[model samples]
Target chain A: MILPGDLSKIRSLEEVFLIRFRLDKKSKVPLLLVVFGVMLILFAILNIVLGSVRISLHDLVRVLLRQGENAVYDKVVWDIRLPRTLAAILGGAALAVSGLLLQIFFRNPIVDPYVLGVSSGATLIVAILMLTGVVLEMGTIPPYLLSVGAFAGALAVVILIVAVSGRVKQVVTLLVIGLMIGYVCGAGTTILEALAEKENLHNFVLWTMGSFSGFGWEQVSVLAVAGGVLLVIAYLLCKPLNALLLGEDYARSMGVNIKSLRVVLVLIASTLTALVTAFAGPVAFIGLAAPHIARLTLGTSDNRALIPATILLGAVITNFCDLLARILFAPVELPISAISSLIGAPIVIVLLMKRRTSL
Target chain B: MNVMQTKELSVGYDGRTVVADINLEALKGQFICLLGPNGSGKSTILRCLAGLLAPLHGSVFLKDNLLYQMDPGDLSRTMAVVLTERLSPGLITVFEITAMGRYPYTDFFGHLSREDEEKTWEALRLVGARDLAERYFNELSDGERQKVLIARALVQEPEVIILDEPTTYLDVKHRLEVMEILRELSRKKGITVILSLHEIDIALKSCEIVLLVKNGKILASGPPEEILSEEMVAEVYGIESAHFSSCLGGIEMSNSGGAQVFVLAGAGSGAPVYRLLNKYGFSIITGVIHENDIDYYVGRALGGAVVGEQPFEEISLSNIDQAASLGRQAEYIVDAGYPIGSLNRRNVELARRLMAQDKVIYSLRSRQEFEALYGVDGNKPVYCPNLGALAQRLSRRKK
Candidate 1:
């Protein structure tokens, strides 16, 4: 029997909320989210203002606001910097969220789209189109054909992995299979590169190296719409994803449909990876490291918090890296992958060392 | 009322039947255990019942609805499972883990309502883990993790909870605590607690019904008292040397080809002697013990040759003569210093007769105390103060 004192001791909803949130000291999450928001905005503005030409913030704002615009500055910002900046943000966020999804799906912290052959699959198909001149032979290259090819290739790999996942219960075996698929796709890309013409080879090599430059408004819009919709879908999956962290048996026991969740997880992760790779040329490190950064910063594994935090961190990190890529070498314009790895690899290493017990 | 019933259920993987023709019913509030050795398909049966795996043939019914036909959400609301897999979900608090049990009740985003929070806390309190609610799940010990997992299942407010070796990794205290909590959950909350267990002693003591699973089938299913016979247990587990005593509710390993030692003991005095003898590889012959004494049970469990008498009866001459004859074959005699009461006053006379016959009797009392009890002046038995001293003396004699 509960005494009157015990009934009074039963926590109120406010206290329960405090106790629950305070367990991870998750009040830090909101503060960190606000900080990340500011950083994202700062990096986005910096990306717009600090290109090779060095457009001032005032002129950049004017071009953004469509007031008091100089033609050269307007053209540079509107035609080049604006789309590239937005594409970097979207691509980074998409890759990070995709990485988070696959990490959870595989129940392995290090797994991401790049490691799982998804980006390689997209790259291989894009290489075929670019180097083999298969599409150039048809007169004009359709605008969205690369995106379609990347999506199909990425989806094919994801479907194969999903089918193999159904048969293989061990995560290590599945990871090995993914790595083998990556090698095969890489081999295919190498053979195509060897057979291509010199001019085609340079373009294909640069594409393979990865960049956030030269994104058009059309591609940016596609990235924005498709990536936004998939991110929302991924957010909607937070409950099941959280349940799944306890493993499939516990998740299924909690009423999650494991088969469908697996399919959906792979589908979203691959599509996001493919979408970004189609535009950004299989950018590395961001997909593999951004989720780890989010998890480390937030100090929680609840996907509801993780998904948004990862998206914001991914965008911020990618925009900062892209800014560095442009300004670090000045007019030389180093590949974004080099700059990303230079920064992302150290952060991931530190995170691994600090959290040897967990991701 | 029956909460779950399986009809001719044949469970297995890839259409290969593991445990076939299984018909089991889980009544509301009943605590049932599936007792078996390793690889006995107990987990397979539990998986099928929990709807985690499909039955190869036949159907499972939850209440009146077909188990497979029921929606996953509806099924989960009625049943929860605590599996054996060790969860290492990084950075998840115990509260968060427990609150995940509210999945069937929560909204699309899994925001815990006030009622859900209350239930989660209540569940934590029920498992005596309210203090660990704020702690990270990965930091907990195995026993603490187990309590939290049970709390997670309890938060579901399930009608039936299925577990796979829930206490397998726990210490003795935690094992009893977990069993007690499960028993309370069944008795107080009317939740049917079904679990597969390797602990036969715990199963016999706590479970209302036990199913002896072996070789892809349940060999027997009934109340533990009715079905857990020594022969049945030995047969099911394929154990030849160890004996399962219904009276003692434990298994005792038997050692063959050891030195014979006759022990004069009664009123729970001979149990430790019998165990120590068995441990030292000495065959035991304990005598003059009443049928209802604990020594009778322990001695019998250890395969000791027990010379017995009827409960509450005087030590009969025939029983004492039988013990004397058995004592004659033994190399040594141990007089467990039991009190000379009215019903067992004849045991002192038996000890005196053995001493007069030149039999060396190891006594657990002082020489004066043995002489006063046996009413003898000259003839004396070797005196040892405790079981430790007696064991030393026996080991010395063996050397």
Candidate 2:
């Protein structure tokens, strides 16, 4: 919180931080539009090139095309780095958008999409599957099925909070209820995990680690469909989402169909979040931090600007962190979730400190 | 027949009803004010009519369409509102906030059409916030924020606009500015303007129709001068002895003789008294204050002479001499009740001096105090429920 030169004027740092802003409102979207697009591509390339095997760009592209079949190179690129990189990019952006929508709908800065016990649900199912020695075939229930389960679980938590209201409707209470639900689900998952057999426990540990190595193009296609559908629905409800920022009554007064919008937004955000978490194992803090970064950069709640900004920021940050995670440990690559928490925490703090004095 | 009317509209929150039998209306291009006490259900009725709240008993008809039955898009095109709602107050520019008012007409992409953009700009100009269009909405002062909120409501492109406490946090200039903006909007766009206000003076000064809401219903409605007659005000507010008169104290002192009369008051205790005393020509005088009181500053701002005692350490014979001189010229001596029981002799002496003067009308605790000062009969002291009582007393004294 750096105060400007004069307190009497009480001006915004948006101007003093003039390097970031422009006055020509219509001239937006052109310059940063191209820059963000290129940034995404660069990070994606880096995520692929920096992993353990030194596959050349040509070899990687050839392997992606199913042409280059040198066993070691194909395994490194096809079976290891390529799917992981794609998962990082898609999962990052999807969760980021989900967080953005949830924050806007609940009108709470701390309202992460996964906070509604979503990841807990996925973990519970995976734990159950492990404890029971239910060996899911390689492609039987891809991350897509997990994501669908998580989406339903997230929706269930929301319904629970809505129904459980002897308490106030303030943001703090909502956050506490979400956290309580998460803890309860986590406890259930833990009980199942404690009773699991050794061989089954080993597989569950790998799933919980959230690797990109398990997925391929078929899984990517499902991610694409879920993310695309959710993003489209989120975009359509932008006005109502923004209106809800002023409170439900005000939004109602403005002719926003709140009940329908709430149902649609919750469904879409939950699905988007569930998809990403399923594929990447609750990529820590990306959903929470990416939207704040987008808001800090773009400075508006109009979802048109916020959604695109969050998407771009999500891609760049997640891919960049994933690149670091693989290269830092090199041959014995670290979990992408660990890298996300490391970078995402500090950025979220800066955003909170700056906006604390206001709603 | 009013353009926007309610037939026994009973509005409430959750399962509990607040305003039950509210029958009210506002003609096209008219400014209607709903005046009531804190829990009198003004906002509930406003919300129900705005289609934000459901009616428990009856329905709201907006230009002949049942408000609840209309499609949100269609209802939004014909309705807009300003409320005392706390928002994110994000880093949005005033232009962006006003632009959101056009959301009903904007497509899914939220791109403002040429017509929408023009209306937003015009709305800003109308509220005199055109210069602040580029300013961040969250960073503005309360007055400026109120204006921006009003501007946002105006750009909703509605046939009727409802505001809840439009002047709640504004200064004198902004309060008048908000009222004037609503007035001008009613005239220019033929939009029915309805707002609830606690500022009785502001309602008297501006609104064409004053609806008195109390006990879960509208007790009266019509022009401010007619419907807001002395008796109606008294009944609605539970105020004692409301009256309207041109002459002060039965004497025609001047063309404007009977000004609102404010008695010398204590810290914030005079707020109600000041308000009740307030009329167009009435002047304010805050005094008999110790140096370090919050209301002493308020009284100072109210711009009246004060019979202020000096700081205790500095209260030599010189300060007492100064106090005594002013006390002689003082017309009304309302006991400020400083440091009750008079443990300090200075307050007792000051009280003695005020009660001693025949021309100075003072209200003390008892007839003994009155008889000890001006030597009047030892009758019971009149009970002052609020500022209005003090004003009527001062007005009577002016005769």
Candidate 3:
């Protein structure tokens, strides 16, 4: 019979480790958020200044203030680097928030937009538009139409996955089903690629490789509006998301309308993934890795802290990865997905190995 | 007043009824338990009552309000539940988890108000988990985790709290502590506590009302003492050999048929000996025990032949003669060394007569004490000090 007085005397080995590390304290969240905020600013600045043309910080600041003398440098800063930087920030934050939502919804650490095939569904629709050019016969296809198509395809796949999730309770089984859906979409994209004209096929292949190279203000605005609204919705859902950590039955008992929460979570998550995939052509790993980074750095599972921290970390890491993609191969400009996978995959593996509880 | 009541309720999954025709009422401050064997739909009944599952027929009323018709937020504020599901929310603190019970009351951001925080701490203190407030939820032991879960339910401050097998994974000490906490909550705080449990003895001692569920229906419902008859338990649990002794508040396994041992025991000295002998497959015949003695209850529960006497009556000649005839057929005799009061003094004479028949006797008393007490000089019984020594001697003889 352990009395209340005896509980403090009983120091388990796990408690000893927790005390030594001081990892479970809620006070650490604000400090970690400040650190992430600084990192995000540094990375955002580096992304703008260290592009292929190598604009200096003074010239970049002068261009941003609209007082630059050099036309080429000003154009490079305002038209090229600035738009790509904003795109990376918005897209990364959206994908990360999407991944966090899916992870919590499925109650699995490995779930994300890419793993659940939301990005592939969007990719398939965009591939059909780019490779086939069926609508090009009428005129040049509007980018808005592509975004709409991608949203439709992504929503379709999300609806399908949600339907299957209801029937299949096992997380691993649902993951496999998502992988199978991705394969079918990939096969469709491959068929279009095999039959396309060479010039169109080349552009389609580059798009499939996933880069933030040609992001213009038009794409940036779409990402900002859609991703910004979805992020606010995600933030508003923090309370129920925290309740869901105990799982669905407990969450429902606590008065969360689970069916509607499911719809809202999948809608926001898939739309965010579709929006990013529509403009940036399916960037990888940021969605899957950023939430885990937030969890590890914050050392807590409270969604109230994790949501904003994940947004900052995602924006910073994606911008950093995009900068690496531009600089690593110099004139060649490697795919952003390649750099993101190289850095993000190893970090995710190490983080998962270190924390064995949340699987 | 009745805090929660159900009428003609049937619960199941996907339209298939698991249990039907359940009518139950829980009054304020009443501790109610659903007692049954495994797979008897105890959890189904509880889930239905908690509004997690819809009943197939009839309605559940919470203070004149329909349970199924109430809003989820209102239901949550009025009732709380502790389920058997294991939680592993990563890196959440105990205080944070317990404060989750205020979910219904918290605003859109779920920020804890001063009152919410105070209630959270109060619930933690009530469950004796305040010391663990700073610790991670996953780092705590199973018992501590259960306490934290209960604290979470308590923080809801519901009029009624329901639990589905809250003590399933706990050890004996934690089981008692958790039950005591629930018992106190109902008794002192006036919260109607409802739970399903497999521990019949604990339910019998602690619960004010018990619903015995079997197959696909509730077999009976009433106070545990009035409804939990020996036959009812045997029938409900499908026991063929073991006996549930209401007086002993536990079940005793049937004794195996083996070598006969006549034990001269009275009072409570023979209970442990009866258990040890039953464990070793010895058919026990204990004698001259007054009807009200604790040994008589244990001996009879173990299916041993106990020679009985009226309460507070002297051990009579007829009882001695019957015991001596029974002892003659035994391969060995045991003197349990019960206190020699005037009422049970004939038990010693029976032992002396059995010893004179040249029977081997294992006596707990020493040789001098046995001879002085029996007033015998030639025939003697072997002195074994304790039950362990006697067991060793008995096993050797059996081999």
Q: Find the candidate with the highest DockQ and give its number.
A: 3
lDDT of 3 at A11: 53
- TM-score of model 3 relative to the true fold? 0.91
Looking at every candidate separately, what fraction of the true A–B Cα contacts under 8 Å does it contain?
A: 0.68, 0.61, 0.61
lDDT of 3 by residue, A12-37 (tens): 65567767666445567888899989
lDDT of 1 at A69: 43
Candidate 2: share of reference interface contacts reproduced: 0.61
DockQ of candidate 1 compared with the true complex = 0.51
TM-score per candidate, chains pooled: 0.90, 0.75, 0.91
Clashing pairs in 3: none
Task: Give the per-residue lDDT digits (tens) of candidate 1, residues A1-359.
Answer: 99887776674554576466665465788888889989999999999888667888777778778894489888888899889999999999999999998888878887877767887898889888887857747754563786678777887888888787666656568789889999999999999988888987887777777888858999999999999999999999999999998988889888998878877887788888888887777888898899998887677899988999999999999999999988988888889889998999999888768652465
DockQ of each: 0.51, 0.39, 0.56
Off by over 4 Å in 3: A1-27, A126-149, A162-209, A345-359, B356-361, B374-384, B390-399
Could you tell me how far off, in angstroms, the CA of residue A102 lies in candidate 3 after the best superposition?
1.6
Better candidate by TM-score, 1 or 2: 1
Instruction: Quote fnat for model 1.
Output: 0.68
Query: How far out, in Å, is residue B217 in model 3?
Result: 0.7
Q: A207, model 1: CA deviation in Å?
A: 3.0
Order of candidate numbers by DockQ, starting with the best? 3, 1, 2
lDDT of 3: 0.87
lDDT of each: 0.87, 0.70, 0.87
